[model samples]
Target: MRDLVAAFGGELPGCDTPGLLGWLDAFSDEHWNFRGRLGGAERDRVRVELPPRLAAAGLAAAAALGLAGSGEPAHREYTHLLILGGLARSCLQRADHAARLAGALRVGGIAALGSLRPLSAEERALPGLGRCRTEADALAAGVRAAFGGRAVPVLVAPPGDPAAHRANTADTYEFWAAGAHPGPGDRILVVTSPIYVPFQHCDAIRILGLRYRCGIDTVGFDPRLAHPPQPGGAAAADRCLQEIRSAIRAARALLAAVG
Candidate 1:
């Protein structure tokens, strides 16, 4: 896989520091302003602000690498690499989003998804977080139906693991079975968590590449300071960031090959 360390901003030693948020902030400053107003009473309305911010970040990063869309170049051509974060499982469970993404992709483009599976029935039976089960199941089923017979390449994490907890492995498998290959033309890369214990979705991509005979890549970054973190001292956040960077590099290489 091709490496794009510069695309991710700068490389730092050790994954301890919160780098993802730093990258996001740097990207936002160099690209566009990400503003959020707290006047809304509807929680959904407030929540809707996240996707745009993320899209902006992704777009900005692409731009920094000279991979973003632009009209100034007159006849500039570039492949669209769709990267979907593994949160809000609903986005993946519903086929509309996936179909829309597919439609937007050019013949030699790549659609990369980062997702997790729905909570199990047993997990859902618990209070508080239990409500998430229905949403997860619905999304999972929707995703399966959306690409049921399509020829989209997919990479996915295994079920019941932390990495696969919110990812749709079944959907990835279905797409792969439909003949999604990473070639000079359009393709899909469904990165999943590895089969090892304490699995993370990041591991899935590496494993899927080997299992399916597809070229693979990996990277990591820390996301804790940007979100919430666990109590006490643990290097989990650093490890995650390191893995993310590895994945990013791999993706860049794949893009270079296809471009």
Candidate 2:
């Protein structure tokens, strides 16, 4: 947290003010589990503050990603990052806002995403579903046209529900079937829950660790556990943090190679 604050090279909002970190820390301590640790009230606190913090950090990290690789300082005011959760509406909403900010980038600019899964056409049809689907599709299409190819090289991993996941996977397959190659510099990452693997053909897990040169780490917490619970939750969070760091490093390497 302190490192994040220092990265901004300025005071963080509510950082020095009394009870801010204390409140956030308290919330984290309370709701760190999944079963029943966090009740309605504590959950509300996380829903409110966590989004903004993640968005801010994601944007900054993305800019840093670009800068470290291309030496072209990111000029955009915002970065696009996506976050998707199995049943978390708040996470999706925050992701929607972040995607909007990222779309403001100029041509050749980067769109850094942190998503549970790529948006489906069904989700796109919903009112106010946001730009993840739209922008991603557009970018893919643009890359294809530029390369003059009949299809793009995409790897899909469908959801757990065989039928629904298959449908979604098929839709993406069809899209890519008609898409052109996305040039060397263009890239996309679609992250999903451990259980969801819609596309049976693609080794999504392997792609994360080897192909895209990155992987996601997750830590599960049961909310029913006691406050400041045993070592389980922290261990998970640590694993997640480590995996995220590894992914950042991998992404940086990819960007550098392209540059």
TM-score top scorer = 1
Q: TM-score for every candidate vs. truth? A: 0.29, 0.24
**Backbone-clash count (model 2):** 20
Error of 2 at 181 (Å): 4.1
lDDT of 1 by residue, 82-172 (tens): 2233333322422334443445443234444433444556435433333454443433443444456654432443444454334343344
- Candidate 1 deviates by what RMSD? 14.0
- In candidate 2, stretches whose alpha carbon ends up further than 4 angstroms from where it belongs are 1-87, 107-181, 187-259
lDDT of 2 by residue, 1-259 (tens): 3444344343435654334444433343343322233352221122222345544563454334221111211343311111223222222332332233334433222221222344556445433444436433333332233234333322332433554423232234233323322333333333222212122113322333233333322212222331122233222322222223334333344343444
Q: On a 0 to 1 TM-score scale, where does candidate 2 land against the true structure?
A: 0.24
- lDDT on C-alpha atoms for all candidate structures: 0.34, 0.31
Q: Against the true structure, whose lDDT is highest?
A: 1
